[model samples]
Target: MGATVEVEGLTKSFGSQNIWRDVTLTLPPGEITALLGPSGTGKSVFLKTVMGLLNPEEGSVKIDGVDIVSATDRETQELRKRFGVLFQDGALFGSMSIYDNVAFPLHEHTDLSASEIKRKVGEKLELVGLTGTETKLPGEVSGGMRKRVGLARSLVLDPDIILCDEPDSGLDPVRTAYIAQLLVDVNTETDATILVVTHDTNLARTLPDNLGMLFRRELVMFGPREAMLTTDEPAVTQFIHGSPVGPIGMSEEKDATPHHLLGAMDHLKLGDVPPQIQPSEGMGERAGAVRHAERLRTTPDIEELVIRQPDKELERRPVTRPAAYSAPMRGLRQVGSLFALALDVIVNIFRRPFQWRETLEQFWFIASVSILPAALVAVPFGAVIALQLGTLTVQIGAQSFTGAASVLAVIQQASPIVTALAIAGAGGAAICADLGARTIREEIDAMKVLGVSPVQRLVVPRVLATMLVAVLLNGMVSVVGVIGGYVFNVLVQDGTPGAYLASFTALAQIEDLIVGEIKAVIFGFIAGVVAAYRGLNPSAGPKGVGDAVNQSVVITFLLLFFMNFVITTLYLQVIPAKGA
Candidate 1:
């Protein structure tokens, strides 16, 4: 169904800090509207309010005649289902493949079968000119590609209304123009109502059927594009022209001007210049009449092109068309695309291996730098376990078994799990934090634009690297625990080193080492992907990187413990015991 968005007398405030107050606007169906404003002016907040992601303290917003804020939960959900959002940073889950990201809404919202999902995802990727990059993670592609993938994902929902937050923020001039043209073309084709929030005046000026400026907790201006663009109002004019002088003030500067300069500027205006406006010379006389006659010959139809230029000017420049995706057909294309993506991923894994480098650095820091902590833990822990078992042996008149008890407690269970936890605390958090920071800095976005999946490119590599480390760390723990226990055995019970080794060998089995290996493998993947995913979804700007980093470590630790427990339960209960 076609949709229209209408907001009435919206008011929202946090204590004394008002974001927007009594803001009202009507966005007609089948047109692009831009919410333009300076930074911190609440453009994003307004877009969020429209999306029903936020509720105003006082106001009513209706999409297709349904009141979003007052609607039932089901109604609210249905309302959201009608609209698609392209977050400023793409917001593709780092752990998921590009194909999975595009297919997410379909999977979540529909009961479509796997084959159907693949077809739909392929079509959307083709729509965004990303046919073969599906299996690759978001991190491997460039910024532009990531944004396009975000657009493709938004389109997968087949939304009649699209909400884009800062769609053109970091792109270059050419890419920005391409995006603007793409939006217009998409709107023309699909007739979707689009609302874009951006601080870029070029995008704001060239696009949009209607323009609105958020300021001082309210929309100070709202109107048709041409009307707003041609206005000389202080706030609107100053912002549009990139001027520093306006009602906006600086605390350190006093407002003073040369009276003569102001007077001369005022006196030189108006009719003295004999009107600077000029009529189009190319469409004059016979040509104008011919065009007018041709217009009458055909049905009246006018579509707003964001860039208005003469026919002659356009004829001279080569026109670039938006990439189109063919409707999916037979089995071959589906299989082919999947194969291509897999090949791309395999190639990328060996290409740069950035995450591999990071993992190696992380492993080095964890194992080498953390030696003191390991020693501290092992010495006390080994001594305590040995002493406790020795006291119990004396009570039972079996004091010789102290060496065997220490070997069972420290070597079989304690060492592997403890060392794994330590490495997770040290290395896992670092991995997550590092990746998360890169994501916020747009480094991940860079990879997406280059048609590389950050997951395939970054996460897979890191996962592999960490797995190797986990295996190595477990082996190291076995060695350290043995040495630690042997020292305690000799010092306390006058047990020989040979006896300590002999007892450990007698009790330990290959399966125990294998169990530890399985846990490490899972832990490494968990830590790597968690960190990568958190990094890729970081909030806007510099501070968000730091926030993502901090959150990644905390979340990774929790997940490690949770996953370890699940693995342990499966090993103990799900897998048959020796007798079973």
Candidate 2:
């Protein structure tokens, strides 16, 4: 049975900018509701808030009586199991084949056998008219086909509530009509509470059993479809009629427009109410259909509009989740959260059946990217250090000890720092971008919906890989650096090869090499954690992902330098310098 979703007093914002406020509505169980709004009125944000993927500033979203705002992670995950969302672009796993994409939830949440899963996948494919297309990837399909695949995947869960965000976004009119019918047929079959966020007026007018519109950040009207179509509210009339002369101006996307343009946002009217699309022949009526029809007959024509004046009591109600944290505490909070995530990663490292394969894959990838860069940098870096040291030693008439000075500098500092820079610049940036893309696509949300721990599943393996690659690359840099320094000193500085090799052992100890490896490990941990932290919480879109990647590199470099300083200070204090 479809679950009832009750949203009350919902408010959302980003920084100081409010997206919407006081959003209250009820999605009657086993009914199809289409929410109409201008292009940038936070329709997608509303879907995220409803799913608990994004927290609302002040509200309660009770799904089958579980208040999503206050629900624990586990509770939220379980609640999400009852939900299936089709994002604007379908949000299909681009890498996975259509079959695998549809089967992803089953793989995550169920213990079903392979043959059984295959059969179910086939049935869903057939249901969406996509049976033979199973082997094809999402990228290989047409836009309409991809939307159908997303629909099939969403339906596979037999969820109690379904959310489709812009199902007709890129489709032509003919395909859009097919999609509309597909959705109606789906509702008839599953009887799930469904919310469709769209801007298609034809869709808005005909498809939904219930109709609603969001304008100026509030739900302007919501009720029986007839009531909305017949209402004379300027905004409602303007939207349903799909006219340009409405309050939704260029400022529809922005906060303020010129005062002179305010009157330009004038008027439109709702024309004749077209015949509402009904459940198709041979498709049994939805559970809510009879009740909705009964309401139309019994209720007044003015419509029981969901819009309301601000309730003073509800206005004073506490928001379990604030729109934004105070600026002063945000930095401290981020640092604390990073520490907590570090601890979590450390603890998860020892958890049984560790992600050895993923860790190894990441290790190979990071090592491949970092090794050449570290080696190339180490050669010149080592040469520069040895040349400077040899010249200083000659000036002091202590050329014999120049090898010791150069080797110690390279082994104890240059090698690990170079390795850290390589890992962070090349490897860390990629990690941040990958995770940020996943975060923005709601793939992480999908994992959580299937009761998977993203940190444990994704972050842990990637972090371990960074550490392991650091250790490996540290050795590579150390060897290359020492050889580069020795060659540069003996060949370029007019020094004896025997003296240069012998002086290395004259003053350096095993502890110096060990300390360098230690730094590499800690630096790798810092880089990985910082990258993952930012990636997990990117701002909003592709731009957010790019921003996160850049931030990861900057943050990793700063932390590496600071950590290098602390480690160097501690190492010098704990272990005295070796004697010549």
Candidate 3:
């Protein structure tokens, strides 16, 4: 049997912007409930809180007598297995095939064999009417198809409770109706408790056994469908009927004047309320309906169990000036988060079940994909340095010393910095974009729900691979830079080839090479961590991924310069130079 979720006095806020507060509700077991709210009313936030993805400032969410908010990490993970969530965008991993995406939860959370997994996946896909497109990637499918695939994945685990966050979003009415029917069929077959968050009036009116609505940062009402549909409450009527004439206004609140001018001036014609849609003919009675009838038999008046808690009135207050430490506080929080993420990567690195295949893929991309750009930057930089030094030595009648100066500078400074810039611009940007897209699409959240640590599966391998590649790339750049300097000194400046070759090592010691390699490793580690952090914590949409990539590049550059200065200063003071 499915579990009942009980929430009491739930409150959430971001700084001074309170999303919602003092919210209380109970989701009956084995029934479908619909939560209706306008845009920005925090319906999605409520879903996320229930899923334990976001922690609320106050309140408790209990499932099977365990409080999710206060549960230990292990307990929370175990509890999450009982839930199946379909995000608005479908949240499929773009890189995986449809078949693999559906099989992900089973592969991660179950001990089933490959054949068993295939059978279960095939069953769920057929259940969702997606039997044949198994080889297609998410990007190859339409919006409606992706949503169906998400539904299939969610059901693959046979979860006890299902949460659909705007499943009807971005779909036409016909497609929406099809999806609604699918939800009904799934619930009837499995008898799992389902909660759908949407603003579609048709869905709000017909799909659920119970209805709830949020407006102006408050849940105006939550009760059985007949009770809510028959109520004369201004906000509930205006919202469920899709009417513009009541408490709902253009600004998402009631208008001050009784008669206010506005667009879409349609009234809530009570007589026009459509009857609820029923399951298709020949479909047996829903398991939920059977459970509901059983409950009614035990207690004759079920309406008394409906919750209609009164809304708490908040006091109006004058706006106060913003705190001066807000910006610093935000900065400190980001720094702490990044540090914690890096520590997680370290802890998970040595754990059993290593991701060797993913690590190799990352290594190939970081070490090989960046070769051309590294060469391009290194060659030009070497020629420029050689030309300047050659000109200066000619004036001083020390032309042979140009080789020593060029080689030492290239080894001690140019190769490491140039390689870091190439990797940060090329490989680092790619990592950020890849991870950012996954974040915005909800793939990261899906992985977490399936008991997979993105740190272990994605971040650690990339970070280690980048660091290893940076050291190798530094060697390549150093070789190319020295050869470029040799050609520039001998062919263009008429310097003696013998002197150039013999004096190259006069000032460039083995310690200089070691310092450059060390710097490359440090820079690569910083860039990898910064890119991963920015990508994984993206804001919301496509624009958020772009913003994350931009920030990753900028922050990496700043950190590289500062770290280089500190390392160079310490090296000069602690390790004496061999030659002038």
- Comparison by lDDT, 1 against 2, better one: 2
- Model 3 CA lDDT for position 493: 92
- Give the runs in model 2 whose Cα sits over 4 Å from its true position: 253-272, 297-302, 305-326, 351-353
For residues 1-580, could you state the per-residue lDDT of candidate 2 as single tens digits?
Answer: 6999999988998756677888888998888899998777899999989998888778899998899999997798889889988888777777789999999988877899999899999998987788899899988999888888888888887887999999999888987888888888888888889999998989988898888888776777777777788776667766777666555665755433223344654445455788777777988776667777877777665445445434446534544434247786777788898899999899888886688888988888888888899999999989999999999999999999988988888888898789878988998988898899988877787666555788888899999899988988889988898899888987887789998888888778999989888888998899899999999988889999999999999999999989999999998999988762
Candidate 1 wrongly placed segments (more than 4 Å) = 12-17, 55-60, 70-75, 95-100, 110-137, 249-380, 384-487, 490-492, 495-580
Q: Per-model C-alpha lDDT, please?
A: 0.65, 0.84, 0.84
Candidate 3 segments whose C-alpha is farther than 4 A from its true place: 253-287, 293-304, 309-312, 315-325
Single out the weakest 10-residue window by summed lDDT for candidate 1. 270-279
Checking candidate 2 for backbone clashes, the offending pairs are none
Model 3: lowest-lDDT 10 consecutive positions: 312-321
lDDT tens digits by residue: candidate 3, 1-580: 6789998988887667777777889888888999987788899999989988898878999997899989998898999999998988898998899999999999888899999999999998897788999999999999889998998999999899999999998788998898899888888777889999998878988888888888766677887776678765667777776766676777755443323422233345345435656666788888776666566567657567566535333413322324523778878889999999988888888986899999989989877768889999999889988999999989999888899989988887889888779878887888899899888888898888777888999998998888888898899999999999989989999989999898977777888889999998898888889999999988878899999999998999899889988999999898898853
Using all chains and alpha carbons, the TM-scores for the candidates as numbered come to 0.55, 0.91, 0.91
> What lDDT would candidate 1 get against the real structure?
0.65
Clashes of 1: 17
Model 2 scores worst on lDDT over the 10 consecutive residues at 253-262
TM-score of 1: 0.55
Pairwise TM-score winner, candidates 1 and 2: 2
State which candidate has the highest lDDT: 3
